[model samples]
Structures are given as structure tokens and as C-alpha cells.
Target: MKALIIAATAAASLVSTAALAQQAAPQNPGPVIPGVCTYYNARLLAQSSAGQAVETRMQQLAQEVQGELQPYATAIQTEATALQSGGASIPADQLNQRRQALQQRAQEAQQLEATRENELRYTLGTQRQKITEAVSPILTALYQEKGCGLLLDRESVFMMNPAMDLTDVAIQRLNAALPTLTFNRMPVPAQ
Candidate 1:
């Protein structure tokens, strides 16, 4: 049994060694195609100065919304405190009515919060679309200048020549084009 265990251990070690060697071997990516290029759109958007500005603005808007909602939150806390502290002295009918009123207020607060969230989402989505639109021309210009006929997202390709990466150049062009974006919370449409 001991001899069998030793053989099994040796076999496992050999298998693992072979697997590691295969993983470490450099893959032979074929020669670059002349008209094909790739760019990481997500990286371009996330790392650009304009994108950072938008994120900062979004955080400011969230803080503003929280400020606007603070009074409602305070009111809810006050009402809950009153109920918890003085419930035994109150008549049962009056207590029920107060509880119902509190529930109603809470529900209204939630609805208002949801509306605010929707507004933020709408604003952010519209802003992102605008950013994409602004980037489109830059991307087109880069592709044309590079003599590229095919543009692929970097995420779509497993491996490519470093020269084919257009992300950094695109970001530079994007920064030159749009330094910062100005936006506000768009009103949620009636639903």
C-alpha cells in the first residue's frame, strides 16, 4: 500500500509540473493584420479626466439629494421615538391611528427616495450616452489615421500585439476633446 501511495504521488507531481509548464509557455499569436485594431472602451471611459469629473459631479448630486431628504428622515425618527417612549399611556384607538400615520409617512418617504434614485440613474445614463457620442468621432479619426478597417473591443480578443492597442491614444484624444462634463439631475418622466 505504501508503494502504491508513492507511485500515485509521483504521478500527480508529474501531471502538475506538465500543466505548469504549459501555462508558462508563451503563446504564438499570429502576425498582426494590417486593417485590424483594438481598444478597451471601458478603460478609456474610466481613466479619462472627463469621466472622473462626471463621477465627482454624481457624488455631489447624491450628497445634495441626501440633504434634501434629511428632514423626512428626522421626522420619521422623531415619530418612532415618540411611539416607543409613550405607547403605554396612549389609548388603543389613538395608538393604532398614529401607527397607521407613521406607516403612511414611511411609505411616502420610500416613494420619494425611489423617485430621486430614478432621477439620478436617468441623469447618469444620459451623461454616459453623451460621453460615448463625443468619443465616437475621436475613435473614427483614430481608426482612419491608423488605416484600420476593423475595430474590435479589447475585451473581445484573447491576445493581440501591443501595437494594436488604441486605448491610450484614444484617451488622449478624448481628454483634448472634452475636459469636463456639466450635468444635473434630469426629472423623472411621469409613469
Candidate 2:
């Protein structure tokens, strides 16, 4: 009886394993309307060729800014170290002057940082606008080509079928149309 029960348990386990193995993986649902409506994923902009170029350019600009500021930082650090080590030996008036000069240098460095940040922000915004301008016509052409009567921004939707996504096609078209974008640190206009 014990042997028979063990054999039955083994058979049952094998049968369950076989059933699980036969089950199919979940498939993506098709679009509700094959061509009448589609969605564009705006978040996918970063994956496009132009977007990549912008990112690379931004990195280069950031590195340049760091290089430009490094000397100012080193000078400030050197003066600060000198003041900290020998401030007691200096005459009162001279010490005060040195402290004030150090403070002024720090303030200047801060101002330069703010200015560079503003320039970087301006450059980023302008580059994004250029990319948007380039993408707009491509999206329009895709809408027409797909016979889509309704176009939805992916951000605005709650849920969507994979078939309705046009982001990949849009990126492909964008790569073929505008491969790379060139941009510079746009000077921030005086407020």
C-alpha cells in the first residue's frame, strides 16, 4: 500500500509538470482600431538619434564648464588654505582684508556657477524645441500614412494595446530624416 501511494504521487507530479509546460505565454492584445487611432510615446524621444546627439552635446558642454571653473576653484582653495594656516600671524587689518577678498572670490565663483547653469538650461530648452520641430512633421506624416483619424499622446492614456504604439515607427522615421542635431550653449538673455 505504501509503494502504491508513492507511485501515484509521482505520477500526479509528472502530470502537473506536463500541464504547466504545455501552457502558452501571454500575448499582447491587438489594437481596438487597427489604423483609425494610434499613440505616440513622448518619453521615447530620448531614444531617437537627434535626442542622443543632444545628450552627447550636453555632456560635452557640462565638461567644458567644469574645466573653465576648475582654475577658479583651485585659486579659492589655495587662498582659503593659506588664511586658515597663518591667519593668526598676520596683522589684524591684513587678516580682515584677506578674509574679505576670500569672501569676494567665493561670491564671484557662485555667480559664475549660476550664470553657467542658466546658459545650460537655455541650451537644453532650445535643443528640445528644435527636436520637437523636427518630430512634428514626421508624426503628421505617420498619422496620414497609418490612416489614423485620431492620434493620442501616450502620456494622456491610461492603458493601451501594444499594436497602437507608433513610437518605434516614429523613431525609425526620425533617424532616417534627421540623423543628428547640432546645438550650442545659448546665451541667456538679460532679464
lDDT of 2 at 181: 88
Query: Candidate 2 regions off by >4 Å?
Result: 1-26, 34-43, 156-159
Best by lDDT: 1
Query: Scored by CA lDDT, what does every candidate get?
Result: 0.79, 0.74
lDDT by residue (108-156, candidate 1, tens digit) is 9989888887888777778778889989998999899998989998767
Candidate 1 collision pairs: none
Taking all chains together, each candidate's TM-score versus the true structure is 0.77, 0.77
For residues 1-191, write the lDDT of model 2, one tens digit per residue.
22323533554564454345435313655446856555444433566888778767877887788888889999999999999999889999999999999999999998997788778878877887887887789889888887888888764655566566678888888888889989788899988
What is candidate 2's CA lDDT for residue 99?
Answer: 94
What are the runs in model 1 whose C-alpha is more than 4 Å off? Answer: 1-31
Give the distance in Å from residue 111's predicted Cα in candidate 1 to where it truly belongs.
0.8
